[model samples]
Target chain A: MKKVRIGAGSGYAGDRIEPAIELLEKGNIDYLVFEALAERTIARENLDKLKDSSKGFNPLLEERMMRSLPIAKKKGIPIITNMGAANPESAGELICKIGEKLGLNNLKIAVIIGDDVMETINGYNTNLLETDEPLHTIEDKIESANAYLGADIIAKALTLGPDVVITGRVGDPSLFLAPMMHALNWSYDDYDKIGQGSVIGHLMECAGQITGGYFADPGYKDVPNLERLGFPICEVYEDGKAFITKVEASGGTVTTATCKEQMLYEIHDPSEYITPDCVVDFTNVTFKEVAKDKVEVIGGRAKPRTSTYKVSIGYRNGFIGEGQMSYGGPGAVSRAKLAGDIVKKRLSLRNVRTNHLQVDYIGIASLHQEASDWLENEPYEVRLRVAGITPQYDDAVKIGQEVETLLTNGPYGGAGDFKSVREIIAVLSILLPRDMVKTDIVIKELN
Target chain B: MKLREIAHCRAGDKGNTSNISVIPYDENHYEYLKQNLTIETVKAAFKDIVQGDIVRYDLPNIHAFNFVLYDALGGGVTTTLSMDIHGKSLSSIMCNINLPDIRD
Candidate 1:
């Protein structure tokens, strides 16, 4: 009959903390998790750490900890987060400092590390998961390499009875799964229970996503009160059966539609969802709308866990330069097309070396590219966007420069001309043997 | 009729690949989707953006079909020159697919 009410605090790093505050105040949850890290966030954090030794954790870590720490401590609810980004040790210290400022004494904070595998990565001749290319090809450009740690180590951190557990580059779902494993005392080798926990973690990891934040489509898939969207909560039982719901007074509805959408979101294979803990089979997963706002999730099968951990390698890929100019009036489409051509020709004349270039009429064929076609009635206005991927930073700037030239030189009635260039830190993945990487937890308690 | 009329979809990306899940508004339309939502139909619709293979996974228990498009995003979110790097808007495109009308 024992159950844990887990509340998803923040979905991503920059997610609003108000909903999380609501969860702590009204939800009466036992565990609160903040799934803050994204695929490229840690890499960007590593770059920050390179500049400043003390930097590299989530930018809003102080703000989040300052706001949530007192409430979570008062409620006796353990908090978990991947806000540590590239540096959990420093993040833990900062949290301790914030807790002291808040007058919170005896606040136990656990910082989990060892996801970074930059040193060990070079030793293995692993091939990139996406492409057949070996890791050696872009070794020089590597910025940060962190493996996706699973729930076992996180559960180990929980055994120490910490009020808050902060980690770097752990699997998004593992944050939620760890709490379940610790609370329910589930064995690591129990793939079935691990699979169920993984499903629950995956579903709750995105917070408001399952509660209609991204499910709104004007008339087709209408979600009400989205403006005040409430994050999701899972009332998970010891049996691994959980009810996905939200706070009653809050906005957003937790329905079967939203649950189904989130179940397969970002998942490649339905039956074979590979998490660090185990391989989940979501195909058999069932959602029953037992109530208006509560959907009962059941039946998530699984196989054994994989021996290797997926490491996300971030490296300097190139630079992307983009330029945009808007055109209006009766013949805007034609004018924009002409403007696009001018930018292309100008780039060629400037000898701008680019690996990939695209001249798109924004309103027409930008998103779908060749897949999109013109409408029957031509658009009265259009924005021409010229973007290119170049090896050198100077060449990237030239792409946008050419587009900027079209404001007066190439196209008529051009307005809102803009140009920007940014360095691309691309991410690639490789599988490293799990044994090669070791995770260590450092706990800091406010006395 | 359009797929949007009877079904809804959500698109998600991993590396260079994208997965779009199509779920029917009504459970009755599940069979209709399985029939008309063929690989060829999706391939033709996404011919421009998707450069790799398209595979569909069916989940009758949930009444949903997941379409996995490989090498979809120009190169992926970080490296791609395309404006919609994450391919988040690809769901809208999937909803725009044309479907045959069903008899009452």
Candidate 2:
């Protein structure tokens, strides 16, 4: 098999598509993968906006992805992304429309469904619920429930000849691994090879995370032109092992340290790094700096996946209000801390117990000094962020108004105001046993 | 009288700011857990186990409360696999507690 070139895009959430397009254009990579939503990225109002626009949550991803589909069609590179939150079929239809507009009506669009079990959980069994606690029957009341799908659906879609494959809530690594499986025709049971491909996808999923973007290496601090950092790319071999490197002349460097830093991100346990394809063993893995711009990742082991699929659930909850203020200058840290105390005391007196409160003096010399805290001598910003849940809307408003008042009478040498505090909806994530649910893929050839 | 609390119980070493997590065994008690397990309560609960000042965070989405227990475990999470070392399974234990009903 020829070297499978995979390109990953940059940015956390609501990022532009130009960087991803640039990488695909320059590298001529076979697959282009992008991630749009994560647990931390979901916003209530944003979700409502998507519903209003006939799109679901995180529609920006689909909008940007639609803009890139034309280019992807012209270049003959298949595009896969996780922009399908709450409504995968609708998002897929939008992509098809974009394809039609671009005169690429022959676009085969695949809608990966069955992951949206928010409304129909009863159709699936819950024998996977191992705990004794009576699981809430949320099938009827669930606002959103998306299954974290694996690469199998994506590979199946690709086989049906889709120009673009949009998924609801597939695992981040699965987005990259699906392309490899399609290209190599690897079976889901192929543990070793599948594990190898999974490791490669995991490394590149977080965009620039593997390329000094979040590295703690002092030498990497002076990396020039970070505003245009290049996203990471993987060169996979038939054996499943791959080397991670960025565009050769890209701004950031891909060193062993950078790769190691990225590896540690979100990995709670090295031995039990679970994924849809396999349980990757990061323990015996070895990283070798083969070249200045490349690092070889080897010795990743895979085990059987647990018979459960992690489900992200969001529900309607009580209202929550949050406010922030900034304190600058020499005594910024002390004043900010003091301000936070005042708010707490006032809230306590009013019997308003907040669900959460935070006071951070961002510019203290002791904090982030090693990361070149250049703002220490010039000016500093201390922010206080607070939130709470209340059934009464009046209570929520009162909390918001009180926190904003801390700026003038509570703390000196600082400027603060009450910002809008939105309602806090219940968003819960549960891992449903895989045996309980089924996935079906429907591919449509749009012409 | 400032009551020191177990604002949050995390399985990580002491540091300025670190990721603190708790898993509720039951979903129905999630709202109750959120109400009782305030940052102050979390701090007051684990004051003895932690060595530093407590700065609590609200993680509404995860249905868990987080706290930045500063200078607590030495160098924070980097010190050790705090999860393994703590060994208390506070998440399950907290779930067992009978929380007072706070619903309207």
lDDT of 1 by residue, A227-346 (tens): 778899999888899999998879998999999999989998889999898999997899999998899999987899999999999999889999999999899999998888888888
Error of 1 at A5 (Å): 0.7
lDDT of 1 at A153: 88
- The recovered share of true contacts, given per candidate in order, is 0.92, 0.00
Which regions of candidate 2 are displaced past 4 Å? Answer: A40-53, A122-133, A137-141, A216-221, A327-342, A348-353, A356-386, A389-391, A406-418, B1-104
Provide the TM-score, chain A, model 2: 0.85
Best by TM-score: 1
Top candidate by DockQ? 1
Give the DockQ (C-alpha) for candidate 1: 0.89
Q: For model 2, how does the per-residue alpha-carbon lDDT over A364-417 read when each residue is reduced to its tens digit?
A: 422222222234354556655544556556666766677688756777765646
True contacts kept of 1: 0.92
